[model samples]
Target: MASTDTNDIYWRAYFKAIKLQAGGGATEPGMGKEYFYIASNANRSIAASRFIPMATTNEYLYQEADNLMDPNAPLYVPGAGNTSYVQALYTYLRHVKRPRDTLTPEEEKAEKALTQKLKDAQATYRSERKSAMADWKEEKDFENLSFGAWAFKNARTFYAAWEALNTADGALQDFLASVYGADAQKYRSDMKKISGVANDILAPVPGLSMTCSNIPVLDVAEGIEKAKKGDRGPPVGEPVGYERPAYSLDPQYRDTMDRWAVEYDSTPSTGNAKVTWEQGSKTSWKEFGFENIEAGGGVTLFGFLRIGGHGGSHTEYENVKIDEKNSTVDIELKWKKLQFFNVYPGTWNIPQIRETYPEVVDLDEAQKLLIRPTQFLCASGLSITCKLGGQAKEEADRLYKKQVEAGGSAGVRWGLFGFDAGGGYKKEDGTQTSTSSYDTQKGELTISPTPTFGNCTLLGVRGQAVSI
Candidate 1:
């Protein structure tokens, strides 16, 4: 009994020592070290004792404790003292007094490595974040820029030049080049070259010149059509019509006229011709350019200038006063109309808006509105439409039932409270807002507004839940 008691006491002490150092446990400072004895033959003795009858439980416990104290002990701590842990420890140590309690060489090296790694990570994260933010801001700014009237006007001029000449050299191109630099210059030059205006492409404007020489045969045909129809000729008092042929012309006179016709029959070619304006007129739809106005080749001919206007009104006019007899047919050219759009405070359903104005509901807005959640608040002018289907329907039904119960509070004799999803106290807006209600059992505490013009107002009560 004495041996057993002594062995038990030693075993307890040995286990306690191991727990204090290896595991977290209570141990007095300075006193705990006295219990352990360093022995050179401790391992051999422990092995021999294990095989002998003297291998008591206390000895086993002591051996186990020694093994645990060894640095090679087989124990695991998850991600023990990694970079993050080291960094945290470093931060703590920064404020700690360290004259006599400074870190060892290994710890100091680990601290330096961890600090550098963290700095590198932070720098990389900041760089990436800044770049991403800059790119997003630029894209957003570009979109907003496109919304301006000046931007639209410039875009129209640029596109018109490209469309007419198959190149981009109009006011928009010049402005873009000045602002955006040489990269835009190539774009303008490329577009103009594509439009068959390789040299001196005329920018689309009132007085811009187009050498009519190599002009497409189609343009000549158009001119002949205009002449035959006498479209937009001078006033009736002004003499302008197809010349009358004299039936009794002598052979010599006819021969001379034939020579003159032959000389003028060929199409004029404008290669390096320096076309300059001779005269300008807005009302007459005629402008003269080139060297000589009286003789044809020296004059630049520009006809029918058109300008644009705005507002809810649009105008379409035709010049029917062709020559003296034949009237010209009216043609539709420039038209303008004022388009008004409503700005919804929320992402209004596109389909709903389309129900009101189908023309404005495009595919882009339709998809955005349909997918966005109702909880999100949006700016004015933003419209959204949720796709019609199961999830929305279920949510709508749930909300309607909740609102109905809420409004029924004043009317109910027992002052019954209601629960949503599970039935309990709730707010009206909690169930739903800015949405429509549908299919419900009639006369079952249905809450709806008194007046109707695609709108309604209803009052309801809230309830609390009690667990029994």
Candidate 2:
């Protein structure tokens, strides 16, 4: 990470450069973007805030187990931009000349065929990647059991199998970095720390790892209705979730545990009994950006307005539960709340702020407004469940529609989480800070707090299994 001042300068230049350009591709090559990108990929921004275009590659298709297991040579290393990254960029740049280069008829025809092959390759690669990943996860853990003693014990076996798939062909590692996005390296670090490098004799044993609620739309909707009438569970599956077993298996209760370490009617639960956030959690204002705010346009007033705040945010969790039958943990979180006041747009100038908030007489008031909060409880829960698009989401939509009549989601826009699947907006004041983002397509939920939100506490409930 760059020093604070450097980071600020870096971000300023990066944002300014993007604004100067029309986006999708850079136009202002002199704006230091090239310098920032070349400083090493580690310094690059994330997809949500990234001004630099990332290279796409097919190298993951040919990676070896050594590279797959080695943190230094993994298929995707955002920080390093690794080897595959360079290959992808070079491929694009090399092929880019095809458009401008004059060619004979035979060469043009050959080029067309090659272009078609690459296009077909893209589709084939994507399809193959999706199927392979799905099969791998299923084979590895059909149940998707939460990490605990089972994971701790089998951690090495899991890694061994995964790495083994990376053979001379390297198809197993294809787009592996895409799986965790920016967290690829962080995950690699943790896994290496956990079980050591897969095949390394020096690798140490992993010690071991969500109790979050994920409801299928129909089940959750039915549950809600049943709750209203007292006819819950069954016919519509009980709301099942795993939690830290009510009573952790203590050494004193060693005899109670099954010697086989298998789940049964009386499987001894180990570790903590509950998960909590005793005091409410809050986050300071982290800013956001707009999507090509001007799309294909450039250097407008919106360009000057880069960093925007979504105000501050806070969350309170009222309950956490688990169900043995379902083999799942259910975390019922109260809606997260947003807090802020002088939350005027971050890039807004004096005239803009004065016009927006007439009470502000001068720069001091405007500055004060940025830090202070006149309203503690602002917009309701930040739509944790609804935005993920499931039973919870459908239920929310129906609820929202009941408020606006029966036309359906038509003319209805989803203004929750990061707009348009993770972010297309800028970090200006007045925008809501991105709290919980769910990738419905990937069935992944990522909880990230803003850098500025110091009091922000993350919400989660989990347990570990230890030798009783």
Error of 2 at 240 (Å): 28
Predicted candidate 1 versus true structure: per-residue lDDT over 129-197, tens digit per residue: 345434433453432322122223434543333343322224323332333333445434432332122
List per-prediction Cα lDDT, in the order shown: 0.22, 0.23
Badly placed stretches (over 4 Å) of model 1 are 1-100, 140-468
Span of 10 residues, lowest total lDDT, candidate 1: 459-468
- Candidate 2: worst 10 consecutive residues by lDDT? 49-58
The digit string of per-residue lDDT tens for model 2 on 1-468 reads: 212222232223332322222112222211111111111111111111011011000111112100111111101222232222112211222222111225567755754565454445445544544454344444445235433223334454443343443331122122222233444553334323212222111121222100211321222233323433545344322222222101111221111111111111132212111211121111000111221222332212111101122222621111111122332211222223222211110111111222222231112211221111001111112222222234433333344444235333222222221121123223332122444443435333333322211011111101110000
Off by over 4 Å in 2: 1-95, 98-101, 140-468
lDDT of 2 at 122: 47
**Model 2, position 439: C-alpha lDDT score:** 44
True-structure RMSD for candidate 2: 24.3
Model 2 misses residue 180 by how many Å?
Answer: 36
